[model samples]
Target: MADTVADLLIDRLIDWGVDTVFGLPGDGINGLFESLRRRQDRIKLVQVRHEEAAALAACGYAKFTRRLGVCLATSGPGGLHLVNGLYDAKSDGQPVLAITGHTYHDLIGTRYQQDVDLERVLGDVAAYSERVMSASHVCNVVDEAVKTAIARRTVAHITVPKDIQDWPSSGPRSKANVARHSGDLYADAMPLPPQSALQKAADLLNSGSRVAILAGRGCLTARKELLAVAEKLGAPIVKALLGKAVVPDDHPLTTGGIGLLGTAPSQEVLEGCDRLLIAGSSFPYLEFYPRPNQARAVQIDLDPSRIGLRYPVEIGLTGHCWDVLRGLLPLIEDKSDRSFLTQAQQRMAQWNELMETRATRNDLPMKPQVVARTLNEFLQDDAVICCDTGTVTTWAARHILIRGAMEFSASGTLATMGNGLAYSIGAAVAFPGRQVVCFAGDGGLTMLMGELATIAKYRLPVKVIVIKNNQLGMIKWEQLAFEGNPQYGVQLQPIDFAGVARACGVPGWHLADPRLARGVLKEAFDQPGPALVEAEVDPNEPPLPGKLTTDQAWQFVKALAKGQPDRWDIIRTVVENKIREVV
Candidate 1:
């Protein structure tokens, strides 16, 4: 019989194909930590400086390796710190397992010293959240949670109650769980829409004065087929940020992407279109959207719940994106209109060129845009880039130049920080030989730095490039743009990330010349063990989070003086510059 709860967990994890667990050890989790010490081969645990880094590392693992990522945290505040990272796994559709310890069963409802309601806390951010209510539930729940995480491509939360975790499971635990058989959970698909509905949609697409298609994350499965449909209809497709990779960027029918902070050309084209075919997307921004009376809309989706969620739909077809699109393609008469696609491309090129020009301007401490562009040139196509949330996200979106070679992973929906480090850990573990580069901010790194130890323990070759800007950049930018508050809590004293990595046993390097970045990046990837590459960066820089106007800033100042700023007042700012968000 296994002597400890840690042994039981290790046994289950081995069956789940998890060779490594990225995290730190602490007092609250001492029992499990000790158990891990007993069997170092099956489950190699990574100890990092912060929980956020562990989660970020896990995010990378799931995205690059096409496998479930796992991260561990202790009870109370230790576990609470993983919320940002867990949300990253949730919103980005990464299969991640978040296992956290809970205070002993004896402390239930007694206001235990280190207890937080983890189940409820993880509920909104996780696809599945459950507590090991009893030791009997452990083996089954663990297996099932891992399956659901992979099958659903979302994060699963499993809280291990402290006491029973160490309690024997009554017999030798088996490797299989009821969940191992969870394959293609959805069996019966929604029936096809009526013939009249398809005909009406066909007729509308054929006769509409202006036509376009908007695709979202829901279209991931139907991507290639939908691309065919768009081409046949002469429809220019606009993608939600989450739908960025659905239709290959090189496809001619691809017009531009949509949302707040989205491209100006895309928004203009969408506004001008008379008929908009919504495909697999429930894009959140509604105000920029025209009145229902403006565009005749038709939507096709697998989930009936999304049929009419965003805007009113003329035809709400409850079917998979590809299946519905296949029928729609045959009915859609080819049109010669290339005006929308052309106009958008022209604008995209002009703006893209303009931004590219500004990104390379040499300045002291180095502009992040310059770093992003320069790094992209050196990184191989197979490299995986995990960017932190901050001004760096904006720079990366504009400069990283995703040409299909690299798979980009970031917290798109939750827009959380501290994911750069944690997600990279997972990415490295998932693809041991592939290059994993984490673009992190100093502030974001501190939140998950403890994962450095995790990297050392596992000896996973994950390289982190810390953009050492001494501030909570996104918050500072927000305060400067909207609040007009002289950066308050946003300022941070810089920490030598390279020094920290050395202290943790991972080799470290500090580089200022981007020309040298290529060499250093190559060496790090070639290095047999984990490494950290810290680059000093400018902090006053901004991702320009949700742009605001001068007028809005003045109003916010007055509101601060007057003690109140309404919602519309804040919206006014985000509208002016129109920031584009990339997931």
Candidate 2:
């Protein structure tokens, strides 16, 4: 029933349940776009301002929907622009399919207009990368690319020559031996760990009186099982940033997030526990984990390679988080002494109090923490929250309370900037019925400011909150904390983001006074369509870690002594923040 190679490709994707695609249009991909135009009623294309936003939006779609997210781009520069987003998908283990156009077969090596080796250039980021050489190869290549991306939870790429896209659809050659593929592949069966392996993990968990459980993104669907296991062991739950919504922030046993943008309670629990159980998370920070050989550890992960990747474990169970946790539930015995859990709950309470005090501060220049906290108050129960990389990440991790069915994600492993708005756009496209919000820093928003027009074009009701601090807050702290040097090359020029949003036809608000934050945020969220709020926050407020090392303290002193421009202001704010905990 398909007329051309492009038509066949689109039909195959629709058969695989792909209802939407994120892309930018160009001449090289015009044939494919024409096919999309013809079948506009069946599949929709959410055109973006830049190819990079398209790819990032695809990554966001895959993260939120747990399905294959597809992105299309033209040849040469447009195709190359997808690399950064593809790397984000690869690093975070999300399923994404990237389709690119190539120069004509004869013009490939002649350096014709927009001539680039797309397949070769994309090889590093994709699990499967191939070029469609003929019309007969389109069906098989598209099928394989989708199947590989879904099964491996990684990026897959396909490059079709511009000329070949319009060729008449054809079957495999009849004269020679050839193979055909079908688009009805199913690869979502849940794998359970071997009974013996589960028993080993259970025995290790049961042996210790002081137990702590660390959960990650993989545990999103295993919340009930994770809580059951924790309750049985009287273990405190410590979540990684990606796993923020795995357990509610108000849960009694949860110690909040772990690592630099984490809580003191989580750090204490990991350090004091005699036994550790890591479920579905390969948290990369080794320093945040228990010291080597300090505790007997058991890890459960779908991928065997990631079982002991972060910490040494006595037993490793390879299986889906829900499957493995469900199996181990019956074997784990309940702890009679609730002392460890009690102490962790107490620390969590104190940490929450300290955080509340910080969030309530009415500083002359607004504190970023207050913005995140205020946004959290107005969030819908099931809001999908997207955060960018930088100081905004710290505030979101610390202040935003993930409750009900809310979902939170970012460029976790990639730690790339400029993805907040793109991810929010993808969320808005995928689920128009749900409330979507983005927390972006000044730098990250500046990187992808063009996407605001995309939001206006779609008229999606996404709330954009920009922490308008005129500096790269994260890099400034990193320079002082890690490099023991004063900040340099991190300052950013001030921009009226709200004014820019208004120019793009979205309702906008500028909030510089702390007293007007809640009211302005309410007005922005009340808008029926896309809206943005620019909160001008203080740049001197540092994003202090949960537990500061002595060397880091010495480095902070060194940087201050070396004459930072705002050293005195920074010291004053740090003392004021620290005083909240003691008082």
Candidate 3:
């Protein structure tokens, strides 16, 4: 008998250097699962309890490794379950490949059991989606899927019919077949901006007395070149959330994040700058940016469409950041002015002091900022932090400083809940030696509490810190800011996440008292395997931004007038926090 379609696909995956896959088994994918079992020596399959976890694991793997993350699922409901995680990958611009088993070829499109329009459903999230019909097309489809995912830095999907997965291969079976199909879509050649565009950008930056650089994830590979330009121009670097680790936080010219999750110094840099140099970030919040035409802007992006999307660009260099910056640096004049850089550094120092004070407060219920700052203190230099969406994002973005080889990521565009646990699983799986810590809120942790079982099963060394506020803290603040409305259904019953982790066979620590948080957290981190720390954080603390707009203040006032039972208490807490800011 000739080789089965599953054999060829497995060979291709091995060829692509994929050592492991995250997936769930279902009857529709029986043929594929059986083949995987037979090939267990060559490929490792991590059987997750939910298909969503599989997809999210893949997303987390891709983000942590910067490699193509692969996940698999069965037909119909199984495939649908992978949607959210796939969207998480797509939105974050991570490369991921999803394989799904479909109904038998003849059974497709005839109201077959467990059959869905896989391609159409995933088309929006995947850069490439295809259905494999015959063994003859298997190799080609697999090749295209891997290549497209890598080149586009997005999701690529392929569905294999149950019957077709067991069919005799029409193509060669081993490494020869894989080598023949392997092709580098992104070769050594890098895209560079034209001389005219480069020169014009240099001229604008050279003339400006106050220049600010905003870098994003796109500048990840060009850190050396980025710092050189910043130094030459004497510009303070403001990071987008994705760019948090691009430049060291303690750098003389570095002013933390630039939007609502940004620092006061970062806002100051943008407000006073004459020239704004944006690198590889399509930061969507335009209001937080310098107003249109307020500063001469130079944006560098590989995609031409994104060059002028957020801010009107006086000079747009449509090329890779490293290439464009390298060319532009030579033509630019060095600015010796230290005023902008010195002033930004001073503001950053003050902001740091203020944050430290808030983080060290010994409140009855532990302050979330204190937990965030405590985690920051104990984190290893190479720690990878996976943060859940909600107020947890604010604590992580604002309080945690990225330094000494640290990396932080969250569900950026999609902002999905329960991402911290899933992403941590992927990171731990991908980098078994590196410390993976997840920052989650009670709301987010409860959503995927089952993943603790996955961690226990794999014995993955992941540490999760739950900020147990018993409320959707972010939404509570939003309700007050947007409509001055007293929090409605935002409250959550207190859950002992650490106890849940213990029930799942992972170790747990409960910090009922905030003062013992640091000591308890250190013990949890010292454990050899998966563990959790459930710290009770103050529910009333709001994640106020660097600047609260007038409209937001007015809405808050109106809400207060509507008078909820605890309106006065809530108002008093808000006033106290604001007073701390002014003082």
Candidate 4:
């Protein structure tokens, strides 16, 4: 077969060990699509309903596999649709490669059909963006794009003109491109910090009796070392949402997630600690962090700019999570005191008990917490779960316990809707053998409802659990949290997501009664292919934060006093639920 530009790029992708490509077929890239078809055996192109989903899938694939995920789209609007998902990957520091199509080379600035500048379009979201001028530049551009994405842990963009894609390849393939890097290629290898930095961290930790560790996604690979450092310091650990599963939820020292979607115990641990160790996380919520001078901090991260960006730090140790923690463990003194850990454990236990009570309630309108707990009961040790950003995030954070080898992913920084199903599809494609699940709110699920067809088409066994509250639950809560206002524009008509899933050729179940949740969820999980379970939940049940300030309390009371039909009933139910926490 003659070597076309598409052939060169496809061959390079194969050489880079990319076995799959998430993309959509469009008129702008008919030539590229033809080449994809020719090389279909080597690289499977996952056809998605929309270009946005394609980009999100690539992000999801990279997040789970720790490799450079690849996605393709046609010119103009197709490339434009990829911006949101690319931003999600870029914001969260995931490595991804985006290939977009453009018009013929001669029509570059003629105002022809689909002739937008691809470089400028993706410039903000991509660390490396380039256009293929000739067949000779194919290998170098594609190779460098992939390399830069891996080395910098960011997105790389390549736009190939429709005509150029059909040209024969004559580009040079460097030895660097052929040689594969061992271990984790997604993240650049970072060296340990200086001895003085490690010693300073150790000194601060030893001097403070109450030490706390805030672990994030960067600590994913350093679980053992992170735990070792925590144990040596006699500290309780608080997790950033992205780092929720860094250490299992049930770990004695763990207080679950901190900040808005966090537990009470995690807040207590943060407020009570005298020394804070931030490992591999740039948790953006400054209010959730301890005030300056209240607790001294030592931040360990690979990026120097990010070291003290999130919180005020006395010492910044720029290095990999494992390297910094491993180096500091030897220098740190083991603390004999256990009061801090003991108090944290007690508070966590109380919080856990309250959560269990709420989650186990077989109330008429099913509790969303129960949906997560029931799903958790049926999940495998190696299950991969993707959560949408909203109220469902709260349920997943508090109810789902990360145990064994489970992998949890979400839109951490971007926090976009319509990502749950797309992410699950990518995870399913990346690890077909592993069980995949998506926890989404009704609002989010409806936004990308078309992905159900993709799931069914591929026979990807992704179980979707939609928390059908018939409203934008998170936004509704936000209004109450920020100001005492009656809900507006947040109400959603109840949706039959299960029926929609069935229409897409995926089996589904709708659970209105909480009593049937366990059995129906199990049945859905047992299905050999894609399945969706929509559980109607209490819309008024607020997702309370770990701590409520005086102003927030006032806002809540004012919102109730505005006199909606069920305002008093909602207040009563909320008070009753709070009373259960103490009783």
Candidate 5:
């Protein structure tokens, strides 16, 4: 049924239900591209501007769809460019397959053009890496790569030499006796914890009155189970950033996000609770969690290594979130005392009030919080929000309320800067009818600005809101907060992002006035095609944590005393923003 090794590989991918692939073609991968061209009706390649975006788009597609994402690239630098995005996939535990080309078989060891050893280069980021040595090896290698990626929830790589890709697809020699593989592999069934382990976890959760639940990305599909457990325990749900959409913010028991970009209510509950249940989250900040001896904890995770990673747990149950929660629900007793849940809800209300006050502030350069809040007001009920890493993350985490069927994600563990636009592209392609929005900082947007052309060419209805602060806002604050140092080398030159978007054949708007934000955002979202909005926000605004530590306070003072730029403005802005909460 196949003509060549490349054709066989493509056919196998199609058999696995892969309809879309993100890639950029080059000479090294011409053989594979030719096969793709011939099989155009079976599968479609979504050409991207850069190979890095291709990989990131694949990661995004996987995160949103819960399916295997595939990306392709040529040899040498093209393959090297995929490393950052592949690491993003690896760190975030997304299933992705990366296909790359290599130099001719004979010239690989020699210093031939584009003869870099990609297998070794991608070794650290990929869970499985292989190079097809023969035409008969292509099908087996591709099958293995796909199986490994999906089963392990990690990145997998396959490299095909240029000459090998064009060779005829042949069966193994009769005497050689090489094993053949099938393409019918599917995701493994959801695992359930042992009944004894589930009972122990349930007993621990039932014993405490002040129970708190920490949810993360793994809880995405287990929302119903998570809420049922929370209701039974009378617990408050504090979400990690990646799990923002697991439970709606409007839910009475939801205490909002945890850690630096988290909410005040989340901090209060985590600090004050007597018992904690971590469901499918490996939140890294130990300080944000309860003191080791203060609370008895139970953890449920799909990975055994992550069970007690962030907290000391009385019981560690290794299983899928949905399965474990279902197993534990029947054994759990409904908590009669509603005191803890009521207190958490009250705190969440006060936090919401404080956020409103901050968002309404009429600062001259426009507070980024205002931009995020305004965008939230205009977001579709089921919109997909992709945010970049920076101060933009703070605004999105704190202001954007994920409700209905909304989905949200970013470079959570990897914290990469340039993934917002590429992620939005992937979301747009995956669900063409849904509203997809990207919140990007000026620095992050500039890193992969070339993708605007890709969006325009596809005419996707994605809305890009660039928070134009003209600086690396997050790094600037981290310098002062973590190191007690003045900001240096963080400033960025202002650019007319809207102009660039227009040049790329997309509608664009530039808004500097806070009063015009809502109108401009509505216009941008109303556009049938992709659009960009450049909202100039204040650079001096600090992204304060949910609860300021004494050490962080001292660091802020030390940096100010050491001649931090805009010292007076920073002081004024911080005081103005926090004054109400303090009162």
Candidate 6:
């Protein structure tokens, strides 16, 4: 007898270097369930309570390993739930394949139970969406699904009909056949230009008095070459959010992040430089670019289209960052003195020093910066951090130092609100060896509270730390700045997140003292699993990502003295590098 379709698919997954697929099972995909059961030794299956967790777990694996992530789901609502995660993968350029089950091929148009159109639901977020309508189409569709995911570096949906999974296939069922990609597809892949372009790029740098490199995610593959090129050229490197791991954060030329919530050193360099070298970052938001025509720009990217997409470019070179950089390294003239580079490095050093001083400052209402550092101190390098959307994101983005050992995962682009708990579950389950932490706000946790059951049922070691400020913090701050003041409904009713954790077979911690935070954090991190450490920070705290308006400023003067800033009661509002401790 010929091999079954499930056997064929399993073989392909093994071929693609995938050993595990995350998802909960249902009757709709029984053939796959049985196939997975048989290959228990070769290709294991992790059953999650929610499809969302499964997708997110796949995202974590992809991010942590730089491999194509794989997840599975049954039909209808299960498939719909995967959309949010697929969007995350797509926007962030994570390679992940979402294999979902649909109704029998014949029953597709009849609107049977769990009959939603899988292709239509996922088309917006996925790089490619396909349905296995015929037994003959299985091999082709499966091959395309895996290849598309890698080539596009995004999520793709392969809807395997229930009927097809059990059908007979002409194969030995050894787990290697299903995963092989057609050879020709990868043949036309672009090759990088040689030393010619690098020499030209180096000439511009040699002529310029001051230059800096602004990097993005695209630099990951060629991080070493890019670093060498930057070093040889004496350029300070500034990263976008996606560019975090490109260079070691402790590197001398590293200027930190650049954007709306960017660090001061990055802004100072980008705004004031004579030449700005852009590489591998599309940086969708144009606001992140410097003042109009402020600096001459040179960009190098793999995709030709992205070169001038944001800012006007004086020099645009399209090639692989590694290849181009290796060539450029030889051509760059080493200067006798790097005075310009030294000044930029010093600015970054001051920023780092001030950042540490302010973040560790002891104050009444706990500072977010302090809170993040405490967590960082309490956790090990292998621990996982899943940060939430708003101000919490800024704190984690800026302060949470990611050593090479730890798994630092986040929803980068989509910036969805309810992802904190969900993403944490995914990260924890994806890497069972690591301690997983969710840095979320009260509002974001409430949105996906049901996932608490997902954690309790599986007993995953994912901790949730909620900031219980009882306000729509980011929203309230924006309204106060634009509309003149915080509005109604922005004030949230207090919920005992810690109590809820305790009720769900998990321990809880609630703390307000900044000094005592490390102890509470240690207790929470040290505890078994599934916990919440709620911090009762003042809702109107941190004049942080929180902005004050002209009226609020006037009110601050009317309420207090002339030199004092608007009081949030969290800490003194300061734009300088350090956080000032409130007396």
List, residue by residue over 2-52, the lDDT tens digit for candidate 2. 888899889888988998899999988988999999999999999999999
User: What is the full ranking by lDDT, best candidate first?
Assistant: 2, 5, 4, 3, 6, 1
Per-candidate TM-score against the hidden true structure: 0.78, 0.98, 0.95, 0.96, 0.98, 0.85
Candidate 2, residue 322: the lDDT equals: 91
After the best TM-score superposition of candidate 6, give how far the Cα of residue 207 lies from its true spot, in angstroms: 2.5
Higher-scoring candidate on lDDT, 4 or 6: 4
Ranking by TM-score: 2, 5, 4, 3, 6, 1
Query: Model 6 — TM-score against the truth?
Result: 0.85
* Candidate 3: count of backbone clashes, pairs at least 3 residues apart or interchain: 1
Q: Give the worst 10-residue stretch by lDDT in candidate 5.
A: 172-181
- Superposed by TM-score, candidate 6 places the C-alpha of residue 542 at a distance from the truth, in angstroms, of 3.8
Write candidate 1's Cα lDDT for 106-195 as tens digits.
Answer: 886689877788888888888788887644456667777887787667899888767766776454433553433433232343468777
- CA RMSD of each candidate after superposition: 6.4, 1.2, 2.7, 2.8, 1.3, 4.8
lDDT string for model 3 (74-182, tens) is 9999999999999989888888999998898998899989879898899989889999876666767888899888877889999998888988877435543454454
Model 2: lowest-lDDT 10 consecutive positions: 171-180
> How many residue pairs clash in all the candidates, one count each?
37, 0, 1, 0, 0, 5
For model 3, the stretches where C-alpha displacement exceeds 4 angstroms are: 171-189, 579-583
lDDT of 3: 0.85
**Residue-wise C-alpha lDDT for candidate 6, range 1-583, written one tens digit per residue:** 2278877777777767787787878877788788888887877676766787678768766876677788889888889888887788887778899988889888997989999899988988887899875445566676788788887778988888888888887534344434333421433276565566666677887776777888887786777888787787778898877677667667787877776445777877876777778988877668557777777787888778778888888777887777667767788887656776898888888778766876786765666677877777776766767777776776776787766555555677787777778777667666778888888888888877767777787788888888777877777655544344434457788998888877877788898888899889888887887778998775655434212335655543443332223344322344322324222
Local distance difference test values of all predictions, in order? 0.70, 0.92, 0.85, 0.88, 0.91, 0.74
User: After superposition, which runs of candidate 4 have C-alpha atoms over 4 Å from their true positions?
Assistant: 170-189, 563-566
lDDT of 4 by residue, 1-583 (tens): 5378888778778878889899999877877788779987888999999999999999999999988889999999999999999999998999899999999888899999988998998998999999987666776788789888887788999999998888767555445544222222344566788898799889988999899999999998889999999998889989999897798989997999998899998998888889999999998889889877899999998878898898888999988898888999899898999899999999999889888999988867777888888888899988998999899999999999998888998999899999999999899999989999999999998988999999999999999999998888889888776778867789888778888999999998988788898899989988899999988888878898878878888887787678655677678778878787667
